[model samples]
Target: MEEVLREIYCALDQVLRKGAYINIVFSGEFKHRSAVTFVVKGVVENYFSLKYALETLAPRGVKPALKPLLMAAMFMLKHGEIPGYAVVNETVAFAGKKFGSGVKGFVNAVLKKYPTLPEPEGIQKREAELNAPEFIIEALEKDGVDPKTVLRPPASDLVHFRLGRKGKTEDLSGLETLTRSEAGGWFSMPDTRLKELNASGKITFISPSSMECVNAFGDINGKKYLDVCAAPGGKSVYAAEKGAEVTAADLYPHRVKLIEAYADRMGVKLNALQNDALCRRQEWLNAFDCVAVDAPCMGLGVISYRPDVTINKRPGDVETIVPVQKAILSEAAEYVAPGGRLVYSTCSVLKAETEEVIKDFLKKHGDFSIYSYKNNTDFGRLIMPDGKWDGFFICVTEKKK
Candidate 1:
């Protein structure tokens, strides 16, 4: 248990000190059979809260090494059911071994005095519980978050499957359900469910929402289609499945490889290549009948799945993504045939990335008209954060002959 705690602390320290993403660094490291799994998960989930707590509690003159131990101990001390004295003693011992022995007493002193720090009302907040960052909270506040609408913990897997019996899509024969939730319209299933479904001859796995966005737009007729920025190629596979010959392009080779791997898994063929989506090569500039541009932007829409992004994302982050979104949209417009449909989409709800970007693109190219969703989707249905689906925005435009 001590070793597990030390590993968690060390990885967390690396994330704080070296600017590593916590999810990438801590993946699979927290798995253990002991009761400490709860403790470890609690610490990781409330890491930001702990940071806030330490900033509020630690003495002004404390050294940086001592701060993490203090942060970890303070988090466990406040949140863990263990008596405060035992937490302090164990953490002091942890600090002596992890840091130098010289810092152990200081760790003890800080833990001893933690009770004196005035607890902020927000200290009780956990990261996993909110499932979003402070900016999202601010955004929700601006949009008016309803207390009644905030999601409660979901039902057990078996219960959700029972509810699914009322619906036609679920096949509830012989299956071991791992998780279930009704947060959104669909009963959210864990990857285990997908595995079970796949075993029963059901499939279609898309990593990013862009693929789903393009698939949601128009019909893919097996004609040659170009997917610009086709990393982890969800759209390419979707198109290929519908008989479209796909040319998936990414600026980086590694990303192209990911696209190829997805194609291989789905038993679909696509020409995956590395190329700058912005470059106007004469051979590529006016090519292809259909083009899909899943442009990158501030990922405000999918924050529910990735809670840590909001902690790092700022208002300025939107600005950095806007110019890029415009560049790709413009470049993709050129590739579409005179009458071919060009899809512009983002897994972002921010206006700067969605409507504003598309609005600006249409202004520059009056030759293209915004394609209305004739029978495909409810084109104007704004899926708010409080809603089932993540915040997503899609626009389809067609080049005029």
Candidate 2:
């Protein structure tokens, strides 16, 4: 048990200190075990709340470097299956060995006091329960979305997969039929192993919303498609599956390989390359008939899939990303040939990232206009995260000839 806590703390520490993504941290380490995976994800899902608890529990205040370790211990005491007494004792011993004897007393005192306290009240009460920061709560209110609307259970038990071009619908027997998107062809199977099914090559695991973004391009049988910020390319691959000429690009080489591996697994072919979206590529300008700008944002919409989004996110991160989103959108728009179409999408419901960015871009560039589709307003489609579909904002626009 002590050793298990040690492993959790190590993973947590890396996420905090290095700003490493928590999902990548726990991908293979504790993924198989339900109990350990819960703790690993729980610590991140409730990270800020755990920090709020430490604020009231510790008098002298925890060292900044030691905070991740203590946060792991606190989360275990509150939510983990480990006995509280054991959590305290083992953490104390480990703290002494890891951080020295001085921290042992500090660690012991904090844990012993934690279990006796009443539940947090006021801001901390809400923070602990929702794992949402005060700023986010306030922001959501301003956006006219009830923060409770974002309240959702963790990832679904159903495995989402799409069939290859040669695959058959008859193979979908006994599986749950997914709600078809504007661009159809997606399904889910409950209580199945993703690794096993993906290995079979009968299906490629991809999300419906991902393909829906491609559908926004209308008909792209032989259209040149570029996903400027694409990596581990699901949308780009889907475009290729739909018979479009796909060119996927990411900023880094390693991520390009992810796209390569994804293409190899699904038995599809597409050009994958490393190129910065922020930099101007002379020959590529106005070349693609369709472009996909799935810009990086706060990712608040997909917290259930990536729990670390809001908790690790600082207040100013929302402001910092707007320019980047605009820059990529601007670059992607330029690549859209006259009379071509471009789709701007993100895994966020934030208006600043979704509506504001699109509006600003239109104001600067008159050649593009909001191309309307069913169920989508003039700005774009902002789909809230239901347990079934990810919270995503997709807007398809046309480059006027």
Separate clash counts for every candidate: 2, 0
Q: Could you tell me which residue pairs clash in candidate 1?
A: 222-243, 222-244
Residue 28 of model 2 has an lDDT of 56
Which residue ranges in model 2 land beyond 4 Å of their true spot?
A: 151-155, 174-189
Which digits, one per residue and each the tens of the lDDT, describe model 1 over residues 1-401?
47756765665565545555555565444554243444444555565666555666653667766655576677778777778988887888887787779988777777887778754455145333453445545554554543113222122332122111112344533345333332211234454665554334334423323444555446678566998988877677767767788899999998889888767766667899998988875776667777887787665565444434444555566678889889988988888877788877777666566677877888999988877742233332234443334556667777898
Candidate 2 achieves a global lDDT of 0.80
What count of clashes does model 2 give?
0
C-alpha RMSD of candidate 2: 2.3
Give lDDT tens digits, candidate 2, residues 1-401.
66776677777777767777766886656633565566767788777677777888886688976787787788888887778888888888888888899888888888888777777888888777778787887777798988866744356655456777646666566566444444475546553644455666566766667777888888999889999988979898888988899999999899999999888877788999999999999988899999999998887777767677666667888899999999999988889899999899998888889999999999998999998754465698888877656788899889999
Q: Which prediction has the highest lDDT against the true structure?
A: 2
TM-score of each: 0.75, 0.92
TM-score: which candidate is best? 2
Which consecutive 10 residues in model 2 have the weakest lDDT in total? 174-183
* TM-score: model 1 vs. ground truth: 0.75
